[model samples]
Target: MQKLQFPAWLKAAYGRCPDAIPRGLQSETIAVEDACTRVTSEPVRACNAVPPWSVAARNGYAFRTEDTNPVPGSRPSKLNSDSDLLAPGRRIDDPRIEPLEPGTAIGMNAYGPLPVNADAVVPDDIATALDAIQYKRVLVRRLLPRGANVIQKASEYAAGDVLLQKGQRITPERQAVLIAAGVRELKVSKRPRIGVVVSSYERCAPLGSRSCWQTPDACGPYIRTLIEQWGFEVAQIEYISPPSRAGSTPQALHEAEISYRRRMIELAQRYDLIIGSGMLSTESHRRVGLNGLSWFAASSSNDEINISQGPGSRFNLAVSRDRSPPRTEKFEVKDATGRVRESHSIHHFDRATFVNLPGFLSSVTVLMHVLVRRIIDLYEFVETPGPCWEIGELARDVECDRKTNLMQWAKIVWGPRGEPLIDPLPDQEPHRVSAFLDADVIAAIPVCRGGLAAGSRIHFLRLDPMRQPAAPNCAIPQPIEIITEAHHSTEFESMQPQMNIAQSWSCLNAWLQSMPDAIPGGFRAAASDDDIHVLEAAISAKLPADFTASLKTHNGQVDQDGVCFEGESLLNIKGILSEWTCWRDVIANDEFEGITSDPDGGVKDDWYNLKWIPITRNGMGDSLCLDLDPAPGGTFGQVIRVWHDDERRERVAASFEAWLCRMVMDITGLEEQKEQKEQE
Candidate 1:
């Protein structure tokens, strides 16, 4: 073998290897219970029908639909309640079994199979006793629907249908389904074997280092543990030191590298994967000329292992030839077999001393994980043979009457029957949406050092749902509508003695007032001081006039001093109108509108002819934009342009307004508020 200096780069090693190293293994069949975590080796098929036989669908008695013959004074004989309806019954033409009146004694039976030609079998409770007849009298109250009592055979599935396929993991429900289909065994692909190579100097402690721990050995255990968790067996992890310098020749290191490579190749044949642990570079033999083999191969090749596809692709190359010493000049030597696998012209430098090995290795681990996960996904696609169980989300139209609790919100995905056939599990639905927005008395911290303890927070919950942003067609930004401004309170925001009663009253009153039409017919609002007892008394009285007068006269603003005005005040009117200017600017730029109405009645018309200045935080403190429909809906804000000079303020206002509009549209968007107009 030729003596060579190992190039000290980790990328060279990675480039020479494949990303998803192929595994050649056979498939095998296993029972469903024994196949957990195993990849499917082949697609499975159903062996039998799902519901194999006709059986009782309910606890009620089964009888022929024609049993309800309208013959009076003729009492058809009855059978024992415990007897199967399918068993031999008095024939429809039997002389002894006379037809009974509409309201006569009928035998009671549960789980009985219906007899042929019998129209119906009414339960005992439905039939009035004619002479208190015993099990001998047959009676019925109503006609039964055809095929109502029978659970037809093979209703779910048929035999010889695919149950599962190769490269798929079996889930619990899938197992049950397979069982129902009469599948006893399943074939699965062999688990991929992985060899983890941790090439690092820390693996084996050098002669001078006091730390006896080998880096490769220490890291190997952790790597193996993680790999096993991913459902793969970890092969052996060994540590190697820098080649010896005793012989002043590259022969020793060459032999070691060849030995290690050959062992790895052998292991690869048996296992799906293998990983080596040790520093691929050579900082160990600083006093000697012997370097690592990884560096040697890198030095002998001109091509770099580092490729464009992240760190993992660095493992897919041959060798690099370009260097100062020109590795080509020294590569004419032969291996122990008298043949060279690498190019003859490349010089083989010591493979030790590769910098950036640690970071590169870490990145390699991440890349490998990604590749493995991708392989799992591909396998799943190929293995799942049926209509690939999928989750479909659709908006279940709910009438306002059904909107009672959180469960109804869930029923949007689930059916109205309350059983969640496809109900989105809690916390899995679109973001965290909750009905109760906690209320608390919020107060500002006193600037004085003599700290006044802030008021205790009193949380108030409202019966509302959390709102989310909506699609473009509704003309409202958010799909969900929050009828009230019930904000989240944090300790940081409230530092003073928060008035719980006042905050609670404010929120409740605001919510009530906002939903003017939602208030009950006889309900009224009244208020006095911000006292719980006083508020409760007013609620009992249901006096709206008293509440309205008391809040303005006694409770003061009942709002955050700096909070944006939610009322129909002068500030709000001015703010909304001013915001319109900004909206117009956005519309002009985005080209969503052709003209914007200005406060001066000037239609800034022909947006197509104007150039819009792009607004960004860097260029200015804040900017406005407009979102107007090409058509009109008679809603003022819907067609209005809005603006806020402050970014935070703009975001908050826009978000809230979007929600407000959606709520309004969900309610009044359907029709004009006639009663509202009359009151106004």
Candidate 2:
């Protein structure tokens, strides 16, 4: 039988990829107004305070705290807008308020400055306004509260405060904030230029004439859109293809590689990061098959996790290529460190990493998105932290393109004591909520599933090693199986889910073992302390014999920090509470009688004393009542809804799409359609 092994030539090329480009200058300056999407080079602080002067907080008046208050049965006092008679103690700079009789009148304008210790009375209280000048001062009202109707200096942002942080991409809101903080312009990191290398030439030309097909320029524009979505300001994108004359000649391929490399080198100097499309492949010509585009086939190593791990020994081991191909292992390559001095020839390794991913264009789109985003983060020397509670199943579902199954997913982001930090959609909200989950048919399944699932293994080893796993996701254990509704006599029939589970678990268990430094016996460590407890509970669940033993042998310690298992959760509400800072009071307090739905109805209905439980954690609070048109339902002329955590909201959206795709797949029965059409 022919061995299922990667090509030797592909392996050597990948083993020598470059670690990073040689240092080069690619400087350019863009106008601040034209710099949207550019990464910020440095932190931005406020140039000056907002509202440089003490401005009116409300249109009613501006005044000092100390003012005149009307005393019972005393002589009345009359005051005018510009006169100092309204001053406290009848003294302009006095600290205490002067006592006056109940019948008193005063006047003031909203922005007019108050004399020291002199307060101004608003028109609504002293006199009703017919126009700007005609304030008819009536009578002295109730006692005025201290510190009312005044805005202190520096109430808004103060000068020198950091308005935007370094490394943050500029957004409209950020721009507005900077402007509010008195920034007229900003210095930001230049958006990186991209150089694309596509191999569109034909392998053989007909009678010295070139093939009509052009490399699909579709990728070029699509890439632009994707980068913009990632929130980067793209400076430029340039497309360069292999020479059209290089077909059917040995020199043709070599020349193409060299020419493209030269162009990339030049572009690299002008770009912060150079991103190329396609051309990391073994094939001389483009192939339509998905397998033909796989990263593994094109390059020769599994470097996804390595790029994300950081600059450490673990990362080095992940990308190492000195070892020989592994024997009897699913993922194995030659090690990268040891050099073979065969006679006069010595081989030296290159330092860059190569990633091979086999998928359809749509799936590739998502994968590239994840890859580029993570890469940019890595290039900046930061390991982007994973979400507190990732929707692993949903992420898998989306990756597998099983869109319809995602409708059932839901996760809550909460504070300690079950208090929700995000608002949930109110029941009366006019939108359907749903979730989604899916199974990974490829890669590792846990061994607890059993059988081919139990003993199956895959590995990734440096070099063309004989004992490493074949690929990242290959050799997954089968899905878990449980005996449900089976007859007392039929053992296999009784446990469908259990049987599947055993198969998946065994496969995954064997596969993970091939990987180095995994929890001994195919177990992994938990992500957090809380995960340690949940890991035990999950392992204790009824699983396949082989899978259970693997767990038992590993002592329930798995690489929880690496990836979470099905039942384990990593979020800690306590951490969020400890990190809590300031919050704005976005509450409303108003006595509401129902207002007429129709403008023509002059009569106002008594405001409904709607008894709504405050969305509270501490004390009583309220939401202001605003006039709104009610739908046909008599239920709550008012509406209330809660907030959703970010991750949960993203999952719910992804799940809904997955669910739709699953429904379509079910109805089409695509394989059956393909067969039927073929028979015709």
Candidate 3:
């Protein structure tokens, strides 16, 4: 039951293949504008320098810097203006235009080539216009430096400069630069052709079929679409039908196997890569009367290899066609000196690679994202993996056998401390499609591990772009009253006194009554003194007096929708104790060891602190806590925000009382605005 490591298998399979161009991958000449996302077959060079000639950067009078000189407390220098103005599209050699003289200036428009021998320009704003009997005169108030307001020719890029390297994909920004550098055409690699074969023992209907007993062929279309998105072309998708259900006769099985083999051979010759889906497992191959490894071994003299095993690694089966006689073709290419010379390229026909993928939608998705994408990148000569990788804590334990790699899909959720928590989807069975639909990342569990425990840190590849964390909606309202430095001092003597607990609670209660929907199902009853005492003993930290008073007035929220502060709900005594104990366990186990924390505005520099008691939670691991053990310059009992996925620990208020007052103000202000709109 030993399984091969995927990386080692990939290296051994295609490692020796020359880094030279992929065999049979041809190049085509296309307009530069249409080459975005296409891989380049050869390097691209600029045909001409940007800004072919020295041009004026501003609309002003262009003249040699030596033409004018002004002394302190003396009158400005005057120069004669040329009869003809210089503008874009006007040649300097035109009969009407004259070469710039030593004491003369020419009117030049922005982006217009400078008149011959003109080295500087004084902007119109600074040049005073004077009427003269003949043409005109411009008075310069000061001496200007040479080359001022002029864009020198060839400054951006010189002709024959390499714009893009071979094997690089043309991104939109790169394309724009290439086009600007006078590159009109590009030689790009042709999209690799892919053929998909879905071989299933059960009769599956095509999409949109209404057959009551037959399931649809989901893997074929899904894989095809994914391949297309990777810049490859799916030439054909064929389905191998199962034998009659009435009986499994030897003759019927033989005919089915012959048809499947013929289709595979044809695809291998016509396509660069042939993907075989379904009947990937040994048991499934036996049931279908076709063994992939045996068939490939018998069909070709080349070595047949099992690249990897297990559900996720099954697609690593790579089979190649028989080697063919090498054929050479002559083509023309430019050398380093820009000389076009004839070149010869050798290629072997009918040498396509084959990958046997499992039939389940979940496995298909993982393989397509991780394995198939990498294969395409190889063919295209892409040097880097596309998606970003990140670290996250497991939300729950994931159990798997020690003999196989477990590829699990997980949804990323923010923990109460702004850390990323990986929530593995429940439906990982091969046939289930819901897991694929809800997954944000794919976590690859290496072989020889029985399981991963909750809170265990693991690295995962992002399936899609990470979503931005929810913004704190109930932030301190505008016309913000600036809290003085004394308010945040560690000593309470210097702190600004806040409104009494009763007054703050009254304001919050009135606002809640006005907006009944604000707290869905209303608030829970106040916590008993015994319950509060239990919470304090569990966390080994005493609650702030203001927080205790507020809880006694009305404990935590009754429902998730009752978000009271900064997109979080007030936690009851028991809820606070549970959250505190859980975080404490994670810290005690050193699960967050070596993890970095981003502290802002006097917050302590630590991932999690035992003295920070959870007061409110948003259920995704983000919480607002009362910091009893603040940093050196921070005030005690200050409220701070903790995010699960984010490293930031932001101080929200000087104290719990201050936070409560701000929330009341925000709610009351919102209500007043709503009333004003109604009045209007």
Candidate 4:
């Protein structure tokens, strides 16, 4: 199997941060009123045309150009020589508004549409006939322009202009634009839901029963509070206690690993990500926290952790997972002395991501912020902002011990002049906790090395990563959804919408039904219960319901000549088996490695994990499949397309049904295809 790899540069930067999380939810829509400050998960468009119909721009008198012409100001009330004037009993020929004879004027309020057959509005300022209109005589003024003082249809925008785009944060201004475009609702990313697992050295008798001895505060609550400020949903804090505290037996301690493992799995089902604290360090002899995670993955070597562990080595050991037992009876553990220490149990994890951070209140806060912030960015597939490292001049001399020890992150704060200033926080010492409490940002100094002059520009992040300016809902290349009611109605009219999914699917399916030969072999018939069970066993995963529904209709295959998707054959059960087996063998033989942590790629690492199941392949060897294992914070049952040559994967849609809808839309166009069919 190919070895999963992370770019050396990124690994260095991430420190102990894991690569990816599993997905548990999908994008959802909420009313615009409820979406302010939320990030959009998908692009939204104008539903109706702006200025649905032509209307008056301001209060004015409505009339045709010919009616505004001079007609001998002194002409008799009953008749004129030219007879181009209103002759009292004559009927107007247009149906738009109440018909009136030529020279008869119609009054219009601001923003009102002109009466039928009327092409222009003469504003009170421009009419010049306010006093002479009661009688038949008309005043002569400069010829008025047609279409004057009127708002034309589609003046602001057509029916399908994009109003909101994916990854854009909604603001009041954007809300106004959405309202104008008839967007009453929008799709937005859900907040990250976290399952926190904290390890206590000892278990308490019961909740709120501990003696009130004055001791330092626990860091868990503070971490929880800080994360909440980031707009994430924080689940109840779950504590993993040592076996002695729980049952007081060797067997109980031994069983702790299994119990916590079960808990982690259970938590995984409900949370986007799981965080374990104090597991890496010793916690009451029960292997409940980090040790349990390592054993679950059966890891063998921890090179990455060793490098990032820095100065602390006595209690630190990297745990890796292995599918088989070690060859030697004694396992080698890398130590701070640059040598291996032999031990019975090995430390390392391969699949499970674990990071060891000091439990110091300040230390934990800094690390947690970095780790959580990165994960949030990754979950939404957004650009992970980098640290704003700059040369910072220390206001005072920062000093540290000479012995190489734990990495000390000094607090940083913005100076009076908006300059970044670094403040020294005591290293691994509790008495100097004041430095942490008063600080706003943090900067790390080299382990075992510390002595700085007052003036120095040191590397640091803004506590938060540096954010680059981005255009939000400004210009979009293609509109995925549009609100037509906003565009079709007058200023007073609003479009009432149900949803867009049915319409998109109905349109695509209607076109497909029109062309019987669109799919290869005319689409296969639905599979039986026995067939579905067999297929599920063969793939080792329950198929997405929507995908299975489509398969029952066709089984994704082609036995005949004609095809639908660029001559690519949808894999039948047999074809799917063949491809799956080939991949298994390749992975077994170390010929094809799956995934480590890939966030930069549109497709996340979960697609390459064992949980993902392949569904189809193209003639080019590229495969399209379903992600059974999504990131802890990702949407499951999502479709991913993996390219043949580079193994680059791209997430296409949230579910099989959505994927099919997108496929039809992509093959044609999301809205344009339907618009065309409607036109036909």
lDDT scores in order:
0.35, 0.32, 0.67, 0.52
Number of the predicted model whose TM-score against the real structure is largest:
3
Q: How much is the lDDT of residue 365 in candidate 4? A: 59
Q: How many pairs of residues collide in each model?
A: 110, 117, 14, 48
Give the TM-scores of the predictions, in the order they appear.
Answer: 0.38, 0.39, 0.53, 0.41
The worst-scoring run of ten residues by lDDT in candidate 3 lies at: 468-477
Q: Give the top-scoring candidate (lDDT).
A: 3
Q: Put the candidates in lDDT order, highest first.
A: 3, 4, 1, 2
Candidate with better TM-score, 1 vs 2: 2
lDDT string, candidate 4, 469-505, tens digits? 2311121223345442211112111222222334544
Question: Where does model 3 exceed 4 Å of error?
Answer: 1-25, 51-63, 70-118, 121-142, 203-205, 208-213, 242-246, 280-282, 286-293, 296-311, 316-325, 328-347, 381-430, 438-680
| CA lDDT for candidate 3 | 0.67
Ranked by lDDT, the better of candidates 2 and 4 is: 4
Residue 569 of candidate 2: its Cα lDDT? 15
**Candidate 1 local lDDT, residue 191:** 54
Off by over 4 Å in 1: 1-25, 66-80, 84-140, 149-151, 165-167, 204-219, 235-248, 275-365, 375-680
- Is candidate 1 or 4 superior in TM-score? 4
- The candidate, 3 or 4, that scores higher on TM-score is 3
Residues 258-291, candidate 1, lDDT per residue (tens digit)?
A: 6655543344345434343333322343222112
lDDT tens digits, residue span 1-680, model 3: 11112323345444422221236556899999888778788889988787666788998888887777633223456889875555434444422244687789887788877776788888765565566355488766445668989988777888898888787677777888898888999898776677887777543547544456667778888888877765567766777664444576888877866776676666667777667675545553533422343455324333333344334545434445554665667667888998987676656443666666664677677767766665665566543423334555787888866666666788888765555678877867876767778788887655556678877766566664222112211211234354544323333234454456778777666655644544446678888999888888877877889888888887877874355554567887778878888898899899999887877656787899999998888778989999998977787898888887899888877888877766665544433344458999
